[model samples]
Target: MFFKWVMLSLLLSRSLASQQEEDVGFTYNGFRGVNMSLDGIAQITESGLLLLVSTTWAQVGHAFYPQPLHFMNSSRGNALSFSTTFVFAMFSELTTVGGPGIALVISPAKEFPGALPSSFLGLFNMATIGKPSNHLIGVELDTLQNEEFNDINGNHVGIDINDLKSVEAVPASYFSDQENRRIDLNLFGGQPMQLWVEYDGIEKQLNVTLAPINVPKPTIPLLSLKIDLSRYMVDPMFVGFSSSTSALDVSQYVLGWSFRMNGQAKDLSLSQLPKLPRRGTKTKPNFLKIGFPVFGASLVLMLVFIIQFIVRRRIKYAEVLEDWELEYGPHRFKYKDLYIATKGFNEKELLGIGGFGKVYRGMLPNSKEEVAVKRVSHDSRQGMREFIAEIISIGKLQHRSIVKLLGYCRRKGELLLVYDFMPNGSLDKFLFDHLSTTIKTKLSWNHRFQIIKSVASALLYLHEEWEQVVVHRDVKSSNVMLDKELNGRLGDFGLARLYDHGGDPKSTHVVGTFGYLAPELSRTGKASPCVDVFAFGVFLLEVACGRRPIEAGASEECHVLVEWVISSWSRGEILETVDPKLEMNYEVEEMELVLKLGLLCSQYIPTARPYMRQVVRYLDREIPLPELPSLSKSISLPSEMSTCGDISMWSPYYLGSTMSTSSSVADSLLSGGR
Candidate 1:
């Protein structure tokens, strides 16, 4: 009996000690409503803990547990393990892209004094980034790409050790049980997301799992890395979250958090946690109940005043909208209508993909008219500006050679533009489709000639016939759409600028595609009618030669189509530069005239290039082609003539790549018409 009692006592003591260790770390049922102990930049809100560095730019914010937790002393000794589960959300007040996301940081201090903003995630600055002494371990939930840090994309989770450079990373995604397929999660889409991070001390392994709060825990982890924390961590370290923003703003919220140390704890059942208190539910003075009748009368009066004020404001707003419609002439679309038309912007409906957003083909329910819907990414700095530019530049213009803007939609967090669908897609398809013999689509020489003339007429309308001089900065072959009759229609005026006649618009930023950028625009960072002419020169050459302005070649000179074409012309072998697919079917005289015209418009001097009116006349044979300049002289290339614009503001694919959608849609519907 004595021996049995001793054994029972030992068992009870071990059980009690294990339970005590489990309770060592913190657990909060609800961050805002619950009485949980914690620390760091956390704010009690109706929705829970709002974790933010600041409400403005170039700021860093963090939240951490008040007390430090024990870490492994050495690689050879017993180590402490931990498991943490939390629900967080990222949002933007301005309907902009929110980024430089949150990080689960383990550091020596709760406050990261030297933390940097933007892509640094408030973790490290320029001096200490990628250095060894930083001695920090972080599981970063990054929603913005920082090329300097080698980020995969805008939405990803990276394991960072002492640097912004990730040791291992994976895209933010969750397996949807309802859909039975993995769906890419937009971390900044204002949806609550759940995260699970675990560290195994014995194996020195780390695992991170993520999913939507409404979904079950995925069986597999998004990221798994074998790392020995003892090599980097101090004996006791602060563990919590840190986030920062620059230029772009995002709100971070922590609804609930629970953590355990020393081993795996029971999985948290977040569903049972108390819901956030409803707004206006806080305690009020008891005397308010005694004065109910008087208060009710005041409330009724206030409500009447509020309703009258709202009605007046709405009336004024509608009047302003009516005036705007009279001026712009672009129809305003209902958000719900466009959403339904585009099938909720499904990936399968995607037509053309560009840097700023994706173009989808949708059919309007009432009209049964097919339309190409351009959905600009909310996070894009240029998207909203481009959206405005497109409306101003294309909305009022009506021409047979210009893509017609049907309408636009702007809701709380989305901007969309709708255009008439072009059945034949973009001109690049005809120029490059010959590369694949399996596809029989080809543009005859006559069709190509008509396209050139039509595009020139469109330019003429913008520069001379329109009320304002609209300079299309990005006028590449991809921007030329082909209608059902294969007639060229100018499109994609996102980078266009409208200026008064004879006015030179001075823009601080240079925006255009590579190989097509005008030499003078690089030097001036200004847009003029001449800039469009220079791009037209490149486009003309591309269409005539059925080749890109720049192509992979053995020599640098050979890579530039202009230099190579000039060299061929000097050798009296200009025909060699013509597309082999033409098969000697085109008129030699017409081809030569067009080629010389292209060379004339692509002059090294911006002032030397012919205006859109002269280009139109030259194509129509109304004006004679000008004398060619000396081909022997070396051309001076512009120093700043490179790919411009923020690459993060673009989609992953090239502007005119083949779509993964069904072949029927690719053949019939307009794809890459941007």
Candidate 2:
């Protein structure tokens, strides 16, 4: 129904609108005096009109009349064709002074029958201008040599006076073949000067003023000559300019043009001319022609200078320790000084290994600052790259429970990271081995609850408040380091991946400890916020039950601990699942809520798990309790519920119970009353 309405609206819009063509403009400048004529060919295609020409001598002409000339043909009602009207003008005043016209006949319907390979045809009228306009006629030329028009017999054919014969009639008849009227050629005699083609070959160029009386000059100057051709002949057939004189000794001055019997026009020799401006004689240089190559060389030199400047700047900035002390403290030293202070990386200075790298305890020589120098292995495959990325990704991470990263060092290959040493060590020491029973005894139920919240806040940092949302894939108890006050500090992000909002979800290789890994990793191989939720569930179960994900000698039933937590919680017997050290020290309501959150996180489906923000809210009482998880008995218990029957006895009391007397006592009381 929605698609139907959209279609209807589209139809209504189409009915109200129509398509139209918008006029576009292009530029050219060649065939002068014939207002806006172009020297190249113009053709039409599906994408509208295109004019191809060279800029040196070729120019485009604008249509004086409307293009695609439409007219009534009387028989056909309308004729569609393209045509142009032009007036040719010359640039200089050196040659003929006479009025003679030309005829231009365009035959769109005629074809030369079997004469040439492509039915080629040409016509020649006179040989005066660059290339005669006569090559487009029906006749084919035999031979052309030395600017002379030769016949089949190798004899020169002079120009016909038919164009001058019709000069007395109207100019419109110049396109007509109507005979019976003729015109005469009259010209003024004068000495012909040496004419040359002048060009700037640069920006400014000359424009044509007059055409009929001008003749192009040659490169070499020579003597001038005079001739007038009206004394020679009449009733001519040529279509070019000619001169005649009725003055004294007119027969001594004879000017005529030669024409070929089978005619063809010559192409313009425009490409041979130099494009640079002729500023001076042969010895002087032309600046315009040389400028482009010089500018190109200058640009290359400037680029090399810029690259050298940047390399030198990086060398000066390599003294990083000077700025490091300002951001951190004054005790920071460069890598060279640290080598001397640690006595050449001796084994005695080595601290235990952290996820980042092996930590080395170092003491400054003259100062009193004792620091833990984490000597990250340059060959450790995981070192400064991950460290630097984590610092950049977590720049605005403001959570109090997450560990703080001080300023770092980027030396040659080795990374000497300095961090606040946690004196009490990590949570794994107490939970896994029960080593140092003193610390284990000190870990009470209250301390355990605080640790749970602290870790949740740290996950909240990784999930929401950081500059980029970070996934701490390895979030087991081993990664939760404890500071002096036993506060949990989340660490170990070597396998971490970051996702900004609206970015693609992180696709990763299947990593992290096997038991704590999210189920979706096996299917999708992608890390979302739910991945961290899965790891947090395992951590929560570990802190509450004091159980590792996989017991050393356990069967398949004990391998996945999340399945055991849910089974024990749903039977109203979660107390049996609590850490044995607690011994009823923890609150029952809080335990139920924490167990529910873990169950929600450990859902086999990724979408069912809540975000870390939601997990933190549910723990802090900002939201209501979620639904109880459905437990399947197909999952065998690692350890049987020791107190389920005991807790079931209290459920009825909590729901309000009923009391009744025995039948025999009721019967005796009734008889006594009677």
The CA lDDT of each predicted structure is 0.69, 0.41
Record all residue pairs in model 1 with backbone atoms less than 3 Å apart, i.e. clashing.
Answer: 53-61, 355-650, 355-651
Per residue, candidate 2 scores C-alpha lDDT tens digits across 416-534 of 65545566667877676566655644577677778888888888777777677787788888778788888888865545778785566756555565457775675677877777777
TM-score (all chains, Cα) for each model? 0.50, 0.41
Model 2 Cα displacement at 215 (Å)? 99
How would you encode candidate 1's per-residue C-alpha lDDT over 369-483 as one tens digit per residue?
8999986534334345455655756678899999987767654334577888998788887897666654366888888889988988999998889989888888888889999
Ten-residue stretch with the least lDDT total in model 1: 665-674
* Top-TM-score candidate index: 1
Best model number under lDDT: 1
lDDT of 2: 0.41
Off by over 4 Å in 2: 1-333, 336-351, 354-356, 361-387, 410-416, 437-441, 631-674
Worst 10 residues of 2 by lDDT: 665-674
